[model samples]
Target: MYVINKSRHSAYLLHAHIVFVTKYRRNVLGDLHLDAFKTSAAEVCAEFDAELRECDGESDHVHLLIEYNPKVQLTKLVNSLKAVTSRRLRNQFTDLRAAYDKPVLWSRSYFVGSCGGAPLEVVAQYVRNQRG
Candidate 1:
């Protein structure tokens, strides 16, 4: 079972499945390439007191199943993850920027879905299967 660190004031537990696309929706992340980025994203999530259960994606977008403390603002967590991963991926893989034809690595918008009451295993499986 997945656990989230909760305090007295915050009883809510959040399991989020988030997705962000590459700039202009370019297909830059192949299998091997995305594995490295997923590894880095997991590290970033862990630093923020979140657990990255699964990280996967196609060429254009990334999908993450994350469990975080309710006290932490959701928007803040998403912003931090996106910013850190984008910067790191851009630096490590210059080809990503070039393929997308932009100085940035990811697009501005993202998709975040909330899971509550459902089994974590079920949610995680759904997130792993997301495409496009």
Candidate 2:
């Protein structure tokens, strides 16, 4: 999963483990909404030239292991994902909108950790193994 991406001047393999929590700790995320969310999130990743390596979630939060090139801005990618996914989910899923009195889907804070330390493929395998 750690295929190297080459630009005109460089080749790189960068991965980020990101977690997004729902606003107000509400149990708004469920099996009913996961597919749409995952699809929308994958499109968002594609928009930034990133790959959605893996995804999993609970009732209120979601975990994503993403692989992207160095050219992409991590903060911009994260923000767009939060905003676009939040807006799309709320618009598509009535239950999620009803779960929140406010219009926000995701909370203001998020978690992102850089992946390194052994090798890129090894880290990818470790993350893939984590799904179970």
Instruction: Report the lDDT tens digits of candidate 1 across residue range 2-95.
Output: 5545587666567888998887787888887688778888888887888888889898899998888756677888888888887787788777
lDDT of 1 at 124: 88
RMSD of each: 8.6, 7.5
RMSD of model 1, in Å? Answer: 8.6
**Lowest-sum lDDT 10-residue window in model 1:** 2-11
| Model 2 lDDT tens row, 10-122 | 98878899999988878878886777778988999999989998888999999888898888899999999999989998899888888877899898999999884477788
Candidate 2 TM-score to native: 0.85
lDDT of 1: 0.80
Model 1 ranges with Cα > 4 A deviation: 3-12, 119-132
Q: Highest TM-score among the candidates is held by which one?
A: 2
Give the per-residue Cα lDDT of candidate 2 at 107.
89
Model 1 clash pairs?
Answer: none
